[model samples]
Target: MDVNGDLVHGATLTAVLDGSTQPVGLLGALSQAHRIQRLELPVHTMLPVVLRQLMLPIMLDELKAPRDRREWGDRFNRGQFSADELERLEHYLGPHGYGDRFRLFDAERPFAQVAGLKALNGETKSVAQLVPSVASGNNVPIFSALCEADELRLEPGDAVLWLLHAHCWDTASIKTGAEGDPQASKGKTTGNPTGPLGQLGLVVPTGRTLYETLLLNTPVVPDGLAPDDRPHWAWDERPIGLGCNSPAAPAWSQRPATGLLDLLTFQARRVRMFTCETEQGLRVNRVIVSAGDRLTRTPEYDPHTVWQHVTKPKKNQPHQRPRRHISGRAAWQGLSTLLAMDLPEQSDGPYTSLLLRQIGDLRADEMLSEHYRLGAETSGLEYGTQSAVVENAIGDDLPLPVQALLAQDAWLREALLECVDQADQAARALDTLNNDLRRAAGGDPLPRDKGSKPSAQFLQSLDRTMRRLLVGLRTVGADESELLERGQLAWEQSVWHAATSDAGLLLAAAPPRAIVGRTVRNGNKDFVYRSGKASGLFRARLTDILPRAAEERRAAQKEGAAA
Candidate 1:
C-alpha cells in the first residue's frame, strides 16, 4: 500500500496469452461469465500507457535481431547488416531509434506482450499523435468499451430482439424510448431503456466475475475453429482433482487447427484484460462477451453505448477449472476471419468480406477438400474438429470471376495458361495474343505502351501477386487452378531474371531453364553439381567440403574478433 493507502499493483505478461479465460481473446471461456464492472481503472485510459511501453521494444526488435548477433553493448560497438535488410527494417519499424540504446537482449523479450500493442493503439488512437496522423486514413474500429458508465449490458434469451422486432423500434433512437409510451400499432408499447424486453432477461449492466463458465452442451468441437487461437489454460468443467496431469498427461489434449486466425497479430483486441488476485498473485483475466442480448447493441460494437464489462478484483475459486464458454455465432465469426486471412491485407474490407462469405458457406467436406488443394496435410482432422459442421451455408455467386473464366475459354481458345518459358518467342506471342483478346473481351489486359514492353521483372511480380489472389478466390466451379499455375511460373521467371541482373550475369549466354553450369567430370568419375540450388552444392565430397568451409569461416570470425 502507498503512504496515502492507495493500492500499488504490478504484473508480468505471460509468454503466451491464456486462451480460454482471457475475456479479451477471440473466444473467451465465458460468453456470459461475470459482466465487466467495478474497475480499478478505466481500460481505455490504461491501454495507451500499456501500448506505449510495449511498442518501443517491439519496434527495436524489428530494428535488429539481438540473440543471433555476437556483439553487445552500445550501438556503435554492435555489428552491422546489409544495406537491403537494414533499409527494410527501417521502413517498417522506423529510424527514430536507429541502433542507439538498443540492446541485444531486448529482442529476446516475449513477443506477444510487446507486439500486440501497436494494433490496439492503432485501433483506439490511444497512442500519441503530435504530427499530422499517418494512420488517420486507416479504417480501424474505434474502441469504446471503457469510456461510458453502465454502457455494456447482457440481456438473456434474445427476448428483447422479439420485442424490438415486433414493435418496429428504430435502432438509431434507442435512447429516446420509454416503456409506457404510445409509440403505436404493433399492438405493443415501445420497449423501455431499463425495463424488460418481453419474456427475455432484463438489461443487466456489464459486471465482473472471477470464474468463467462454458456451459458445454455437446462434446463435439466445430470444424474450421482454430485451437491455436483457443485458450491453453482451459480445463474441463470438473472439480480440481489430483492426478489430472497423470496418465502421461491430463484427460485433455489441445492441438491448434491450421485454419483462419486474423486476430493473432492484433490478439489483444479480442481479449478484455484486467488485474485481479489469483492463486499465483495478480493475474490478468479477460471477460467473455455474452450472447442472448438483442434489444441493446453490444458494448464493443456500439460507440454510443458507454458502459463496459465490470471488474472482479477478488477471486473465491482460484483453483476452479477454466471451462469453454461456447457461443456458435461468435465462434463462427472468429473462425471465418481466421480462414479468410491467408493472404496479405486480406482482413480488410470487400476482399475479406467475400472470402468469409465463401468459406462460411462451404461444407466441412468442401473445407477439407479446399484444405488439401491449398497444399495442407489431409491425413485426418485429429485436431478435435472432426465433428465440426457448417450449418445452412450456401455458396455466393462470384459474377466477375465467372465472367472472366467464361471469356477466357471463349476468346483465347489457345490455352495461354501455360506455366513455363516466359522468355520463349511462342510463349511471348501467346501472351501478346491473350492480352489483345482480353482487351477485346473487356477483361484486364496486359499493360503496354510506346513500342517497348514492360520489364520481365515487373511481369513476374504482378503475375505472382495476381496468381496468389486469383487462386484464393477460386470457388468450386472456377477454372483457376491452371491460371494460378501459370502465375506461379511467371513469378519464378521474374525472380530469376532479377537475380541474374543482380549478379551481373550475361543474359544472352544464360539458358532459359533455371539450371546452369555444364557438367565437367574428370573421365566419368561419378560426381554432380547443381547450380540451380539456393546454395551451391557440388555433391561428391559434400560432407568433407562443407565441414572444412565451416571451420575456415569460424577461424576467420575468431581472427576478426581478436584483431
Candidate 2:
C-alpha cells in the first residue's frame, strides 16, 4: 500500500503461516540486515498494536510446543529459531491449521467481518470514510485537501490498511444497524462505543531488533492454550449478522473476552468493502460499517496500558484502570506511572504494563542490558462527546534506559518517579506565580490556555534535562547511594531553575499597576498586592516545593538558633 508516498509491503497469510513475515520490515523501511531505520506512517500508532496482535498468536502457538518460555526468549535474543520450532510454527499458522479460515474476502467467510453485511444493511457508503484523515459526509476538511466533492478512491491495499485501522481505532458515531441487533432504531445504531484501542492510552514496548521486540511484547504463557480461546480469524463458523453464536443476541451485547487472542482480534466493528474492476485494477468505492463486539468490562490483563489505582471507584472490584493519555502532553510527564511497579502492600499505586514487567525480567536476567535503550510508544484518540468526533490523535515515543525497566520498584524507577513529582510541583508553583501576578495587576483570572502556558513551557524546557538525568542514572552503581542523592539534587536544581525562569517572565510582564501596589480584600482585612509581595510569595512557595531548597532553609534556621 502506498501511504504518504511510501510503498508498504502487505503481509500475506502464506508468509505469516510459514513464519517468513518480518513485521518490522512490513511496517517500516528496513536497512541492511533487516533493521528498521524508522517507522513508516510514524503517526499511525495503531499499526504497532495491530502488529503485536498479529504476532501474539504465533507466540502462543510456539509456546504450545515442548519448550520453556525462557528458552524462546534466549533464542530470540540470539536471532535464531530452532528448526523443529520453525516447522511447528508453520503448521500452526498454515491452512492445514488455523490459517484456513483467515480470508480477506471469501463468499462463505471473511476476515473480521460479517459475510452478508451488505445484504443485511441494504446500503453502502463511499469508501472515503475508511480513511480517517480524508473528510467525508458532513465532516468539513480541516487540513485535508480532499473533501466530499473530491473523487475519493482507494486501491485494494490502501483500503485494507484503513480497514484494519477502522477496526482498531475508528471514531464512535452512529452506525448502520444490522437485522439481528435488537438495539437498532430505524435500521441505525447511535452512541456506538469507540474501538477497544480507543479506550486506552496505549504504551507499546519497543526493542532494537524485530525479534527482540516480538519477544519483549509477548508475555510468557506458562500453560499453553485455553481450550476454547482463538483469534477472530480462526473461528470455525462465520458470525451471523450482529450476533455471535446466538442468533437472537445482538453483537452490541457486552461479554467478557475469552482470552488475549479474543481481545486482540476482536471485531470492534462490522464492515464490508465493495470493490470494482477498474483500469487501475481493483478499487474499493463503498463500504458498510456498524458496531461489532463491545467489551463488557475493561480487561485487567491488557498488556499495552499503564494501570493506576482508582482513587474514586465506580465499581468496587477493579481498583485499577488503564490511564488515559492527555493530548499534547509528553510521555515523560507520566514517567512515574510508566515506570511504577507494585507498591508495598497496603499502598495501592500506579503500575507499569504487564508486558513491560516481563521485559524488566529480561533485563534482570541479563538478556537485556541496563544501558540498552528501549522506547515506550504511546497512542490514542481524543474524542468529543460520546466519542462522536475525533478531536485529536495523540502519539509519541519516549526512549528510556533499561534501568527504568528494572523489577520490583527499582531504585532508578523510584528516583525518576520522585523527580517527576518534583517537576509537577514546580510547575504548579510557577502557575500559581502567574495567577498571582495577574491578580496584582487588578486583572481577572486568565483563561485556561493563557494561565497554563507558562507552566507548560517550563516543563517543556526541562525535557532534555530530564532525559540527561535518566542517562546519568543508568551509569550509577547499586552501592552509590550518595551519588544517587547528588543526582537527585541536581535534577531538583534543574526544576528550580525552570520554575524561577517562568517566574522571571511573569515578573517582567507585570503591569505598572502591580508595581505601584493595589489593595484587595483578604477575608474582611485589606491586603496589599505589590511586586515585592508577589516576589516574596513566589520565593516562599518555591522553597516549600523544592526539597533541597527547603532543607537548606531549615539548616540555616537551625544554625541561626545555635548562634
Candidate 3:
C-alpha cells in the first residue's frame, strides 16, 4: 500500500503511527497533487479518512486544534483569515502521481526502515549491546546509544520503535534454562516475556520542555506490578482518577454548590450595565436578569448601589493593628499651641484639635529631633538634643506661663516684677493726661478746633492737644497720624477716667497678657490694655452698645416724623 501521501505532519494520525521522512515526502506529494486539482472535500472526510486506510489497525486519536472555533469564525466574519490560512499549510511530502496510480502509502514500513537506518548510522544500537552486561556492571552502552540518538535529531517515536525491535531480538536470542532443550525455549520464555517489541514505553510529545511537560501533564499513575493493571494507553500510564480536583472545590465543598447558584441568581437580579440610546435622549431604566430570562420590567438600577456595596466593607472595617497613644506632655503642649493661635473660622477648631492629637501621637517633636540628628550624623556635625536646646534658648522668651516656670529663680522674678512696676507707673501718668483733656473738652464740644489763642483759644488749644495726645497714645513709633486712624473707632467714644474709673480700675487691677505689642513693621513697643479677661469684657460691652445705638436712631427718626 502507498503510505507517504496520507501521513500529514501535525496531524493526529502522524503522531499516533510515527511519521518518517520518506512517508512525509510521499504524503506531501499526494497533498500537492490534490491541491493542484483543486478538489473540494468535506472537512470531516478529508485527511482523517485517508489516514485510517494508510495506517494498519487504524488507531484514531483526537487532538484539540489549540484555538476556539467559534472565536475564529467570528474573526473570519470580520474579515480576518488567519485560521483558514494556517489550515492550508502543508508540512509533509508524499508520492508524485495522479488518479488510480496515486495512493496513500503505509507509514509503519517506512518508519521501521528509518529506524534500521538510524541504528546503522551510530544513532542507535541493538538492545543486547546497549543493555548493561552482568560481568561489566555498567549501562554506558545504553546511555551512549540514547545520547547519540538524541543528538541525531531522531524523533522520540522512531527511537522508541527501534529500541522495541532491538529488545525483541535480544529476547529471542536469550536462552532459557531447560532439560536438554537449548533450541526448544530459544524464542519462548516462561513469562511469555511479551518480547521488548511490545514493551515499548510511550513518551507524550508535548511542546513544553521535559520538566515543564511532566509538571503540566504527569498523571497519577497507579502503583502496581501487573501490566494489565495499568490505565488506558490514552492516559499515558496515568491512573483513571479524577482529571483534576477543582481549585474552588474545597471552598465550594465547605458550603453548598447551590450557594454559588444563589449568589449568581442574586447578582444577576441586582447587577446591570449602563447603556444609552442615541434616538430618544431620555434615560430609560432597565432591569438586569439572568441569561435566557427576559428583562421585561423596567426597574431602576442605580449604579451608585455598586459603589456603595463595594465600598461598604472597606468603609465600615475597623483597623486591625494597635494604635499609638499620645503622651500627656506632648498632648498638652500641642493643645496649648492650638488654643493660643487665632484660627480663621470656628470650623477650624475641630480640625485643629484632630491635627494636634495626630501630631502629638506621632511624636512630632521627637521626630523632628531624630531628623536633625540624622542630618547631623550624615554630615559629621554635632547636633545636641534639639528640643532641649530650643527650650533653653527661648527659656526667658516663651509664653507667659512657660516663662514664669523658667523664672522660678529669685533673680529672674525680682527683675520681672521691677520691670512690671515701671511700666504700670508710666501707664498711670498717661491715663491722667488723657482724663484732663476729656474734662476740658466738656462733653461733645465743637467737631473741630476754633479761635487761635489764650482763654477762648484754651478750649481750641485743648482739642489740638487732645488730638496730639490721642495720636501719641495710639502710636508706638513712626506715622502717629496713620496709627490713630487705624485704631478701633469704638475706643474714641469710650468713657475716659481720671486714673480711677472703670477703664483705669480694670487696668490697675490686672496686667495685660502683653505689656507691649508689635506690628508687622514696628518692633516691640509699649501699648496699654487691661487683662485678657478685661479685654473680653470690653469687647462684650462694645457689642452691647450696637443695640442701644439702633434704639437711639429709631427715637431720632420718630422725632423727625413728629416735626
Residue range 1-563, candidate 3, lDDT tens digits: 22132223422122111122222322332333212211121221122112212211111111111132233223323332233332333211222211121112222222211101111112322222222221111222322335322312212223222222222212212222222222223322222122211111111111112111111111111231223121111112333342321211110011111211111111101011112233433221221111111111111110000011111224544212111112211111122222222222422221122212222222222221111100000000111232111001000001121111121222222322332332233233333333323322332112234422112221222233333332333222223435433332222222122112444443453323232322222256633332343345443443343333334546879999999
TM-score of 3: 0.14
- How should the candidates be ordered by lDDT, best one leading? 2, 1, 3
TM-scores of the candidates are 0.20, 0.82, 0.14
RMSD of every prediction: 29.1, 5.7, 41.3
Each prediction's whole-model lDDT (CA): 0.23, 0.67, 0.22
Tell me the lDDT of candidate 3.
0.22
Sorted by TM-score, highest first, which candidate order results?
2, 1, 3
